[model samples]
Target: MNYNKLVKQKRVIIERCFGQMKCRFHILQYVCRIKLENVPKIIIACIVLHNVAKSLGDPDFELVEQDPDEDEGNHENDELPLRQLGQQINKKKLEYYNK
Candidate 1:
């Protein structure tokens, strides 16, 4: 089994899960402005709420659609550099895997 392939697939699944979670629970999108010491508690509360809502099969409370034309140019402009970097990183990982 290819470890790199397994890792990449796992990363994609994790991202999709987080995306669904955020879309379903818009309240979790914002950071709580509590004291530093209470930050962990705030995070735990948000996670508990998210899980309860998910278990209840609730629809997304907030879903915003992006304008198709707004970032049309930005996508092409940014993608090339990112693709190159990703390729480089993957190549290095492949080398490590082969070693």
Candidate 2:
């Protein structure tokens, strides 16, 4: 029932949804070539299609496993940038909760 725990749980669900979407809608796995303003509409359409397919009992395509070495580079180099971004987000979340 902790707020942090609830946020983590919701994040897991969201990540799972994205993973499934990427598998079923291969376009999602690639860089979107459309205008940034149109991105949300595209994502919404994909969600609708995904849900409809689920309702119809369509099976999800299995996610193709990529070599981690090919996609994910050295995490050590990313740590500083990620930490800075995470700090900003954490600050905003804390402010929202403190309100």
Instruction: Give lDDT per model, in order.
Output: 0.66, 0.79
Q: Give the per-residue lDDT of model 1 (tens digit) for 12-78.
A: 9777666766775554567756688986776577667666555544343444688978845546668
Query: Residue-wise lDDT of candidate 2 within 1-99, one digit each (tens)?
Result: 999999999999888888999887888899978899998998899999888666545556555778877966577978898788667656655665587
Which ten contiguous residues of candidate 2 have the minimum total lDDT?
A: 54-63
Task: Provide the clashing-pair count of each candidate structure.
Answer: 0, 0
Evaluated at residue 20, the lDDT of candidate 2 is 91
The total number of steric clashes, by the backbone 3 Å criterion, in model 2 comes to 0
lDDT score at residue 63, model 2, on the 0-100 scale: 59
TM-scores for every candidate against the unseen true structure: 0.46, 0.57
Those runs of model 2 whose alpha carbons end farther than 4 Å from true positions after fitting are: 62-99
